[model samples]
Target: MTYLGFYILMFLGYINQLFFVPKVAREKHRDGYVPLYDSFERFYLRYVYRRVRDCWNRPITSVPGAEVYVKERVTHDYGWSFEYTGREVKSLNLSSYNYLGFAESNGRCAQNAVRVIKEYGCASCTSRNELGNSDLQVKLEKLTARFLGVDDAIVFGMGFATNALNLPCLVSAGCLVISDEKNHASLILGLRLSGATIRVFKHNNTKHLEKVLREAIVSGQPKTRKPWKKVLIVVEGVYSMEGSIVHLPEIIAIKKKYKAYLYLDEAHSIGAIGPRGRGVVDYYDCDPNDVDVLMGTFTKSFGSAGGYIAGKKELIDYLRVAGHAGCYASSMSPPIIEQIITSMTIIMGEDGTDDGMRRITQLAKNTKYFRKRLHQIGVIIYGNDDSPVIPLLVYMFSKIGAVVRTLAERKIAVVGVGFPATPLMEGRIRFCLSAAHTKEQLDYVSLVLIYNYEKDSFFFSLFMSFNKTFPVPSMAALNSLFCYRVIIFFILD
Candidate 1:
């Protein structure tokens, strides 16, 4: 049915394109000019994506806390363009990655950030190797190293660039990179730029990873059959899209057994998981030294910008000189660095307050409660119980837009994801849980989900059919028939 739906949509799209070209696609100068985009890309953008474009890239007018004020907009020509309605709707925020709830207008982090801005101004004005590197950058690197239980660390202005720019410095053409299938685009881009021979293992499946590693070791290079210069096993602490946590301990064992290097990207998990909020390594009580490289971003739990790569002092020293970011990209702003330093200090209890621990505990509590309630609600949610990133599967493309719009209308904001971010049939609404969210807020969300489930006869009937068919339908089975057609109808009408 999923494939059928896609094919039908594509067929309709092609038919529409035959008779009409979108205004955006029309060329002003066609004198021996080459088209910049593929026809299929344009078709998908104009027909498939345009139908539900209003559900994404929403403008938020206020802090992305437990609640956010989303600016309203409307489109006159399908989704070709939009105009602001001059209205902002305050909605429950399940969209932002503010895991520890540090994204705020007023707080210790915010206040410190403000002070730093006044003291150092906004921009660093140069690269780290140039005049841009500040005392704040040095302090941040030291703090980040301590936070991750590593020897030393280096900071970059952008999270994505941290991975994309550094990997080439770490590996090259003859190197073998065994990455998780669900690894982020940044990691993929980095590995590609590194010119390494890349192989993908099943997502979160340690056995498959071990299998792939063994095969790569035995096979060597394609033609020469020479041994690889180095082997790097890359995996995420928490996969953002799938909401799955990495099997870190098992992978570390595999890496040791194979004498391979492990690169752990903790972008989503750092300061969001474990008893100490130290990330996957802490969550599993593993020694930080077991992993060769530790990379993380401050954008999530810390509510700051920039990223860090933590490892041994030798690695950090090498990267400072060899990495592209340190040489070319501007250094992290003083204010952003301060935000990280302050938030991290709070997390480590260096500020002489249990506030950081309280937030971590609250986040874990909220995650467990939310996941439990969602499971009881009979929706198919992906990821481990402890992970704050939860993906509630809606399955169909049309349903993704419907759920986002419907939930927004009820004063709840969520992020809807589809291909090519995910497999075509696995479109979902990703809800990011945060410590700032109260039990009442979570309960309200659950109630809203339940209300939507019950109010729509299409979903209710589908649920009943599942009950009759399976006798005891698992979450996946129950989710197989769930549809948002009724909600879509209400929106279209």
Candidate 2:
């Protein structure tokens, strides 16, 4: 039945291409016009290209020393995409994913990175298998394994490429790959390109995952009773958009019961969770050996480029040779590797100072306080209470941009997420809280939100402009609503 549906869809698509689209000549001399190419160009210019011409590509500074500058972007009379208005404004940054506040130039990591650059220049200039591997790269790989409590590890030049290019090498045809529905785009692309039999379970639903696993195992491959060459389960430690943690323990139990290999992605969770910043495995107190492949990136908490795949010695050794990314992609630079090692050292408290501990402790506290304050103000938020990443719900799609722009106007930078990044009506503003964010910053954001919501300000007016007839809730009403939700969302649970 599934095969039949797939064929039907393919046939329909072919029909649409044949009948719905206009036919045209490739050579100008044949029909005096290249109709198809011209039509495509016109469609792109009229519909697709024109839309992006006015949005995106605006410049914003992300450096730490001074407040970040966002140059004013204006549409010129010629309809150019972007033109700077000679105006710059310093804005508070709340959009980046530097979770542990390590993306700074003044830290121990920066110092180490400088020394590394002096020794190794700017680039490795080649793939690891060729002339790219350096002593620093080897040291970084070892440090990664030690940090993740794995036997060995392999490094990749780019984080997204690490997953996209390696998954096919790890699992191929005749294998089965079970993935979370909300997994990152890179994972999705990897799974698609792997040529493996793929199935998606509901996000974070271990029960659903188990059911699918049971069915796949019982049925085996079609027309043959051969068991799958392998069954690999892929999931992320944290759902980046929703700020939800994976039910790792439950998933691990199911994987063990089914005798499947588990591949965990710790891109957002590593160095931001657990007592020693060891990642989800440590946070759950699970044996790292149970996880067949542990993947993570230094871009987040470690404040550097590149990624790693850490697991047993044999697996890392195999990947070193077989992972296409490591074989062809340019190796991570020595400076970047040293930066990560230095950051990991700080995270592990090997620097003999309590600064790392203090940052972690404060991050936890700030996350809790910020969530609680938003709850108190009757803001509908999504995610686990302790997660530093928070999503404030904006049920109306129109309000997403309005709210973000309003905050930006107030010198606060925020990211607005809407379809197709999320489902219709599930628009939100994702706030990434960092340890660098002071109490004053948090309080200011909270106050701004409350004030705007109360005054029916321009931002709030955008909601009304969208034909929303309902009255905006008053402060007292919001407080009462918050109290009610607290009871339902927390107290009952």
Candidate 3:
């Protein structure tokens, strides 16, 4: 059924393009210039993606707390462009990665951030190796190392750049990288730029990883049959898209067996998982030193910007000069650095209160309760029971847009995913649970999903009953049908 829906949309897209010239094709300025986008990319963006584009990149006017005010907008020509509706929809925020609920304006974290901004200005305005490095950066690096239980750590201005820029310094020609199949784009880009031979293993499948490692060991360099310089196994602590937790202990064992170094990216896991909010290593009760490189971002759990790489002091010293980011990218803003430091201090319970542990406990409770509720509601959700990143499968492309749009209308904000971010048949809505969300708020969201699911199932059956001989409906037809269903939803309310 999922494939049928997706193919019908694609078929209609092809037919539409065959008969009429697209707006992109009619542009006069590119007489001799090469096309900026791939042919199919342009086609997908126009006919397939445009219908559902409004579901993403929603502008929010308030702090992305448990609740947020989303700026409302409307499109006159499909999703080609949009204009503000001069209204803001106050919605329950399940979109932002504010796991610990520290993304507030009046809290200690925010206050510290503001104070630092006043004292140190906004940005460092230079690279770490240049004049940009500050006392906050040094202090944060030390605190990050202590938090992760590592010898030393280096901080970077951007999370994505932390991986993209550092990986090249760690591995280059003659080295091999074994990465998870569902690894983030940043990891993929880093591995690619590193000029290393890359091998992909099944997502969270430790056995496949071990097999790949064994094969690589036996095969050695592609044609020369010579031993590789070094092998690095890179996996995320929590996969952002699939919501799956990595089998860190098993992978650590595999890395040891194969004499491979481990690079664990805890971008989504740090301060979001484990009893201490210390990430996967803590969750599994594994020694931090088992993993060679510990990378994490402050964006998700800490409610700040920047990323850090924690490892041995030798590694940190090498990266300070070898990594592109330390050499070229501007140092992290002082305010952002202060935000992380303050957040980390709270999480470490260094502020003479149990606030950090309370948040961690609350997040775990929320994750388990939400997952259990989602299962009871009969929706297929991905990931482990403890993972806070919950991906509820919607399956159909049209339904992805429908669920997101309808939920937003119900004052519940959610993020929808579809190809090429996910497999076409596995489109889903990812709901990021946070500690700040009360049980009442969660109950409301659950009720909305349950009601929406019941309506969606009924309409889906009706649509599926159409005769096979009838022509497949276009994207617009499917969207209109869903819109009508949304209207009925509100009317029945």
Estimate TM-scores for all models.
Answer: 0.92, 0.83, 0.91
Model 1's TM-score against the true structure: 0.92
Q: Point out the higher-scoring one by lDDT: 2 or 3.
A: 3
Per residue, candidate 3 scores C-alpha lDDT tens digits across 428-473 of 9999999999988998888777667556667755654662332333
Ranking by lDDT: 1, 3, 2
The positional error of residue 452 in candidate 1, measured at the CA in angstroms, is: 1.2
Clashes of 3: 0
Could you tell me the lDDT of residue 462 within candidate 1? 59
Model 3 RMSD vs true structure:
7.3
lDDT per residue, candidate 2, 79-127, as tens digits? Answer: 3345678898788777777777888868677888889789889897888
- Counted clashes in each candidate structure: 0, 0, 0
For 73-189, candidate 1 gives per-residue lDDT tens digits of 999988889999999999999999999999988889889989989999998788889889788888888988988889999999899999999999999999999999999999999
- The list of candidate 2 runs beyond 4 A from truth reads 1-58, 64-67, 76-80, 456-476, 479-493
Which candidate should be chosen as best, given TM-score against the real structure?
1
